[model samples]
Target: MAIFLTGVTGYIGSYLAAELLEQHGESLNLLVRAEDSQEAQRRLWRSLQLHFGFPVFHEHLSARIRIFCGDLTSPRFGLNDEKYDLLVSSTDSVLHCAASLNRKSEKSCLNVNLRGTLEVIQLARRAHDAHGLRRFSEVSTVAVAGQRRNEQVTEDSAIDWDRSDYDPYARTKKFGEHLVRELLPDVPRTIFRPSIVLGDSRRPETTQFDMVRAFVFLGGLPVLPFRPDDCVDIVPVDYVADAIVTLHQSPRPKYEIYHLSSGVNSESFRELTAALAEARGKMKPLFWPELEAPFRAIVERLSRRRDNLGYTASRLEVFLPYLVWNTVFDNTRVVAELRRAPAPFSSYCFSLFRYAKENRFRYPYREWPEIATLPSTARDSEYSESARHVSAGEPAK
Candidate 1:
């Protein structure tokens, strides 16, 4: 039996995948959005390269990982009868990490977040009926909480049908949660909601840069249009991934839903800015809460241009609501279960800020080595034979 995992190519998903591969001993059935076996292999390397070098990844590719190349939005993940059946028969659990985070496009969100999730749920249903799935985990977002304010929200109280969401992304994710519950009521399920996942606390390098660019744009400003005291909940990617992997693998977690957030320990704008400013030996940026309306108007206007400023402004435009919401999701459940709190964002924000600024907001991704000769297309029999040797507690050979 193997854990069917999705979104191995995404930032947080990559972290989760790496953790499971390195620390645990389970065989993973990975769903990669690629045209062929070689493309899927390269994509996985690009994503996992942050955590593993070529040799280790190549070893695992042959021994522990099964790549299922398909689209999440397609019927049966665009898999043929044989491939789909192979996936169902070899799977014992699911860790759904794929999602469309394009907040501006309703079509994208609806098609990917809603339709795509339905496809995964359907697969889980088939696998469950075939041989009783061990668990089904959903990597959701705190944005599903809708438009929140200064209040700290708990897992149960996060979702409110009456409240309006900030964007199409949030709206569709909110509905996605509903779909999971309504469609798979009998399956043992877990939902993880992560808040403002920024840089990894352990390192300055990162593959994901949208949020970092937005933060850099904001950080460079001498005068910002927001309240200084408003708490912005930012959690490291490592903590979020750790919580998800730990709880998902547990025999029985105390709660069905966990908010992987900073909660009350989240830093204020003043504190975060001060840390950045002190690190750079520069003056802290001034905040003007009253100017938020006009600043928003300016951002809207700037977002129309087709240049770099316009692109940055557009990114900020989508994230502006969350920055000013001053809301934090309660992490008491996750903290208690994990026996540790996420490192404060203020402690690591400066390193991320400097790295982003210095690197021009892009990760230096290492390409697949030309000298590498590992075959990407491993036969099903090879994967099945390898899967039989790997168990829940034993490391992959």
Candidate 2:
């Protein structure tokens, strides 16, 4: 009875597989997309190194694994009918994690997020009819909560607005969830909705993006644009992984949509900026209160119309909506379930920023369009120059 998994190569999927290997132990047929056999092994090995490190996969578990290559967008997962039929007759669980993360368009989102998910369900229904598989699980997002503006957004709360049916990404996740709900009524199912997935809390190995970038962007600037009231939710990747394991391992209730989130740890935009400044920039907490009234006056004047602001001004204009407003989400249901389970650990903006700054770790989250343009301060020039000459600087033999 193996778990048939998809998205084994993605950030969340990679970590999830590691956890599953530890708890569920190897009985997995991972779905991946690779050009050829060699490349597939290379990709799997590389991903294993990131999670379990060097010696490839963690011991005792490597031999129990298997791989299946296919595109989620294709029917029967792009596998030939013979193979598909065999898969249909074998696996016990389908953990559908593959989805197009592209935020660029609604149609692309629908194709991968919605239709691709339906394809997995179609297969699951066939597999259940054929082999009597046990459960189908999906990795959805807290964003499916969609633009709600309040605290304590509980699991029982009705989706006030069908935000998913509108926003490209949200719609895809929502629609995908819909497919699973609609077609697989008899099969056991679990839907997990995680909030902004952060990097590893302990190892710091990461690729999930959002908060880190925002903090990095602020740290690179000379001035901190202070807005003390706006907030963003942060949740660690480990927590999401842990929650899934908990839900799966437990006698999960039927048709449960669990919001696996931080539940607390709300960071106001100003506090977040201050943390990054303190962590990486080693800058002081000098809020420009004197500039506030004037800044507001300027912003108010510019907001007379959508196109009132010029190119530079409009860029700021476009980004301003995020700065001034955002609500919070709640996760009591999952938290209550995971009362004793290891809680998710998000970065202490200050601590993470400080470590990254002191260690001179690349501010990877920050867009570097003007990195080359910024004149090298006393901080970088000589270090940059000397670093280029390996011949002059002999190895520490």
Off by over 4 Å in 2: 54-62, 161-166, 209-211, 222-226, 253-255, 284-325, 340-397
The deviation in Å at residue 253 for candidate 1 is: 0.5
TM-score of each: 0.95, 0.74
lDDT of 1 at 25: 97
Q: Compared with the true structure, what per-residue lDDT tens digits does model 2 show for residues 147-190?
A: 55445566556354534332577767876787888899998889
Given candidate 1, what's the lDDT at residue 2? 91
Query: What's the C-alpha lDDT at position 268 in model 2?
Result: 66
Q: Of the candidates shown, which would achieve the greatest TM-score relative to the real structure? A: 1
lDDT of 2: 0.61
lDDT of 1: 0.89
Error of 1 at 321 (Å): 0.4
Worst 10 residues of 1 by lDDT: 384-393
